[model samples]
Target: MLFNIINNVRIICAKIVQIAKSGHPGMPLGISDLFSILWFYFYKINFLNINSINKDKLIISNGHGVLIQYVLLYYSNIYNFNDIINFRKFNSKTPGHPEKNEIIDASTGPLGQGVGIGVGIGIKNKINSFIFNKKINIINNKIWIINGDGCMMEGVSYETTSLCGVYKINNIILIYDSNNISIDGLIVTYFNENIRMRFTSLNWNIIGPVSGHSYYNIFKAYKLSLKSYFPTLIIFNTIIGFISPCKSYNEVVHGSIFNKNEFNFIIKNYCIKYIFKKKILIDNKIKYFKYFIFFYKKKYFELIRILNFIIPKINYIYIYTKNRYNCINKSTRFVSSVLLKNIFILPEITGGSADLSASNLTKNDFIGFFKKKKRYRYIKYGIREFGMSVINYGINLTKTGINFCSTFLVFMSYMYSSFRNFCISKIKNIFIFTHDSFLIGEDGPSHQPVEHLKSLRIIPRIIVFRPYNFIEVIICWNIALKLKKNIVCIILSRQNFINNEIKFYNVKNIIKGGYFVLNKKKNDLIIVSCGADLEICFICSKYLNKYFLINIFSIYSSNLLNKQKKNFKNIFINKKILFIESSNDNSILKYKSLYTFILGINKFGKSSNTKELLKYYNITKKNIIKICLYIIKKKF
Candidate 1:
C-alpha cells in the first residue's frame, strides 16, 4: 500500500513538472522512499488534526525540490492528487514553493529558511512544554527538515544549527540530501566542507550517509534520532534525477522541464510495475480525500479550540495608551522585558537573544531560561543573530504564539534575509535592538549603525521606531504588538533619558505616520528628527529660536507627507522646515522640498565621547543655528 502511495505521488510529481515546466523533480524521484518512511512510519501527523498542538512538523528547506513535498502532502491525504497535478499553476493551492498560510508552515523557496524556521519551532515547543508545565506533550512534536547541499552551504543554516546545539533542541531532525550536484555542476567544483565534523563540533548528533532509496535505512536513521538527546543531521547520498533515462547524473535536470518525449520515455522506464493512467487515477485520489475529510473534521474543531485557548489575546489597550514608561523604563530592552512579562498570557509569545541576554535586556527575572529536558521561558539562541531571526519567524508559524529575537543593531545585517521573510509572511515579531546609532562610542564604525536605520526603513511595511526616551520605547512596543501586520524594528539608545510628560496622544500621532511634536510657531522654522538625533533637534531648536524668531515643530515620521491630510497641508505650505539628524543628511533628501535645510553627518564618525562625536559631526546647537541661517539666507 505504501509503495502504491509512493508510486501515485511520483506520477503526481511528473504531472506537476509537465504543468510548471520548471522545478526540481529530481529529489521527488530519488528520495521517495525516505519521504514514504517519514510520512507513513516515523512522522506523527494527524491529518484530521493538522493544527493539533502535538503534531509533527516537516520543513522542506530545499524548496527547489518542492515536488517532493507536494507529492508527500498528496500521499499523506492533506490534499487531493489534483492539487499536486496543478502545482505552480495560477490559482492553484500549491505554488512553486510552500506557503504556510496557503497550506503548510512558512514559505521556504528562500533557501535555508525552512531549517531556520524548524529550529525556531523546536525552540518554541521546547519553551512551551517546559516553562508553562502545560504538560502539553507538544514538545514531543518532531521537526523534520529535508535540506539540500545548497541549504547547508548557506550561512543561515550554520547560524540556526549552532543555535539548535546551544539550546539542545533534540526534537529537530535534518535530512541533508547529499546529491553532490548543484545547478552549476557537482558541489566539488565550488564547495567542500567537513559537514559531519562541523555539526559534531556544534554538538549535534551525526547520522549516516544512508542510501536515499532505502526505506529501512531511513527508518533506522529516524529511530536512532529519536533515541538521541540532541539535534540529528542524517546525511543521504543519492542521485539527483535517479530513474530518469534522459538525464543521467546531469545537473541540467535539477530544475528544468523535460520535453514530452523525454518525460514519456523516462515514465515508461520507471512505471513498468504500475498500470495506472492519470485520468482514471484522479477519481481514486478523490475517494481517498473523502475518507481523509471525515478524519479531519472530527479533530479540526478540537484543535481550533486548543489554539484559541493558548493563543495570546490581541490587546489594543497599549494602542490607546502610548505611555510605555509607566510599564517599563527608558531602555528599549527593558521595555521589551516588561512587555514580555505583562503579555505572557499570550501562549504564542516566545523570544530569544543572540547571546547578548545581559546587554540586550531580552532576559527578564520573570522569564526562565530553557534548560535540557526542562523548557524555560527564554531561549538562549547563542550568538547566532541570523539563525535567531529565522527561528523567531519559524516559531510564529506554529500558531502557538508571538515570537521575537534580539541582537546588537549592527548584527541585524546578518539576518536581513530572514527579516525580509518575516515582513513577507507578516509575522508579528519584535526585534529588540540595543545600542542603536553611533551613541555606543569606541566600539568603532563596525558596531555603529550609521545607515542601518535607513536600510531597514527601505523594507516595505516594516515599522522602524526610534524612541527618544524610555516612555516612547514602551509606547512603541505597545504599538508594535497592536499593529501585528508589519515587522517592528525598535532602535534603542545606550544612554538613558528622562521620560517627560510626552502625551500618549502625541505618540499615537507619531504612529499614524508623522505628527507635529510642537505646534508650528508663527515665526519659527520646523525642526524634524528621530531617535538620538531628536535630542539634537530639541537643543538646536532652542538655539535657532534665540538667534532668530522661529517656530520649531518636531516632526517624527518623514513618510507622513505621503498621506493626504488637511492639517498636514496647512503645516507644510510655504514654510521653512529644518530637518536635523546625526546620521547622513541624505537620509531625508527625498523630503528636501518640504524642508528648507537638512543638517546631519555626511562623513564617518570618530572615536570620542558622545558629546564630542555629536559636536565633531556638526550636529551641535551651533551647527543647527548656522544651518537655519543658511536656509533663511537662501530662501528669505
Candidate 2:
C-alpha cells in the first residue's frame, strides 16, 4: 500500500514537471520515498487547528526542485489539484522556486538560503523554549531542511551548519538528497568535498547514507532524529531521475521537460494499478499526518497582532522622545545603540552582530552571547555576514520582536543575496548597517563604503531608513518597531562630532519622510540630503544663503518619500535644486524631470582623516556651495 501511493505520487511529480515545461522532476522523483515516509508518516501536522504556532518548519534549500514540495502539499490536502497544475505559472501558489508562506515554510529560491533560514528557525524555537517553556521544552518543534547537491555546494550551508554546531541547536533535521547529479550534470568534478566529514566536524550528528528508495529506512532516520544532541543531517543516497526510462539517474531529468516518448514511456512503465490520475487515495497513516505551519498566512497575520509591542514599546519609545537630550550631538549609530539597548529588554527583541559587536554596538550589557547554555538575547555570530543575515531572518519568522543583526555597511554587499530574498518576502527583519559612507576614515577605500548606500537604497520593497540625525534615529527605530510587513535596514554612521543640537518639535513632520530642515527664509536654491551627511547640507545651505534663499530638504526614508509622490515631486518641480550625499547616492537623479544638480561622490575614497576625504571627494560644504552657486549663476 505504501509502495502503491509512493509510486503514484512519483509519477504525478514527474508529470507536473513535464506539464509545466519548467520544473525539476529529478528531486521529487528521487526523494519521493523519503518525502512520503517523512511527511505522510513521521511529520506531525495538525489539520484541525492549523494555526498552531509551535509547528515544524520545512525549508527546502535547493529551490529549483520546488515541485517536489508542491507534490507533498497536494497529497496532504493543503493544496488541491488546481494549485499543483498551475505550477510555475503567473500568480500561482507554487512558483518555479517555492516562496515562504504559511504552509510553505521558508521562501526558498536562492541556493542554501533555506538551510540558513532553517538554522534560524531552530534558533528561534530554542529561544522560545528557553523563554516560555522553562525546563519543560514545550516549543521543541523541528526545522526540517530538504537540500540537494547544489545546496551543499553553496557557502551559506557551510556557514549555517557551523553555527548550528556552536549553538548545539537541536530540533533541526537536514535531509541531504544526495542525487550525485545537478542541472549541470554530475557534481563529481566540482563538488568533491567530503560532506559527511564536513558536517561531522561541524558538530552535527549524521543519520544517513540511508537508501532513499526505501521507505522504512527513511522512517528509521526520522525516528533517530528525535534524540539528537545537536542538529542532525540525514544524507539519503538517492537517484536523481529514479524511474524515467532513458532519463533515470541523469541530469536530463533535473530541470528539463521530458520528450514525447520519454513522457509516454514513464506513464506506461510506472502506474499504480494502471490509474494515472491527479487525485489518489493514499492510506490512513498518510491521511492522519497533518501538522501546523507557523503563521505565514496573510489573513491570519492581519487577525494576529504583536500586542506585546503595541502596549509597551511605542510608549517605551515615547520616553526617549520626551527626554530629547538622549540624542544630543551623538552619532546615529551611538544613538540607535542607546535605543536598541532599551528595546532589547523585551524578550522578543533579539539582536546580534557579525563579530563586530563592539563596533556595531548591537550586543547590549545584559545581552551576552547565545551559546550552548542559551542564557542571553544576543547571538555572537563570528564574522559570517550572510549567515548572520539569513539566521536573523529566520528569527524574524518567529514574529516575536523586530529581530536585528549588524555588520559594517561595506560588508552589506556580501549579505545582498539573502537580504534581497527577505525583501522579496517582506520579512520584518531589521538589519543595522553602520559606518555608512566614506566618512569612516583611516580605513582605506577597502573599508570605506562608497556605493553601498545607493546599492542598499535600490533593493525593491526594502525600507532603507537612512536617519539624517540622532533624533531621526530615535524616530526610525520607533517606526521600525511598529512596521508590520517590511524588511528594514537602518543605516547609521561610525564617525561622531558635537554640533549644536537641532530638534524636530513635531514628530509628525519628521515621519512625513521628506521635510524641510532649514526653511525659515523664502527658498531660491534647494539642497536635498539624507542620513550621515546632513551636516554638510546644513553648512552648504547656510553658506549658499548669502547669494540666494536656501531651502535644505532632508529625506529620512526615501521609500516613505516615494510614496508621497505628489508632495515629493512638487518640491523639485522646475526648482533650482542641488542634492548632496557623501557616497554615490544622488537623490536628485530620481527627480530627473526637475533638472537637479548633484554634489555626490561617484569615485572611491582615499585613506585619510574624514576631513581630507570629504575635501578629496568634493563632498564638503565648499563643494556643495560651489555647485549651488553654479546653479544660481546659470539661473536654470
Model 1 spans with C-alpha error above 4 angstroms: 76-82, 131-139, 272-306, 309-348, 497-508, 521-523, 546-571, 585-594, 633-636
lDDT of 1 by residue, 1-636 (tens): 556666666656766787777777777777777876776677775665555566778888877676777666655556686787777888787877654663466547788878998988887777656633231232467888988888988888988898788778898999988888888888997889988999999999999988987767877887898888889999988877776788858887787777888778766765444433221111113454445346556433444544564434545466325645363325445555565666655444566788898888777765666664454557887777877788888777776655677888889888888777777667768887888877777877778777776678788778777766554555576667666567878777766543342434464565555556555456546666666566666665666667666654444434333443665545566667777665563545544344467676566767777887777777667767787777766644
Model 2 residue runs over 4 Å out of place are 135-137, 274-311, 316-318, 321-326, 498-504, 592-595
- Cα lDDT over the full model 1: 0.69
| Deviation (Å) of 539 in candidate 2 | 2.5
- Which candidate tops lDDT? 2
RMSD of each: 5.7, 4.6
Top candidate on TM-score is: 2
Clashing pairs in 2: 45-290, 45-291, 46-290, 46-291, 100-107
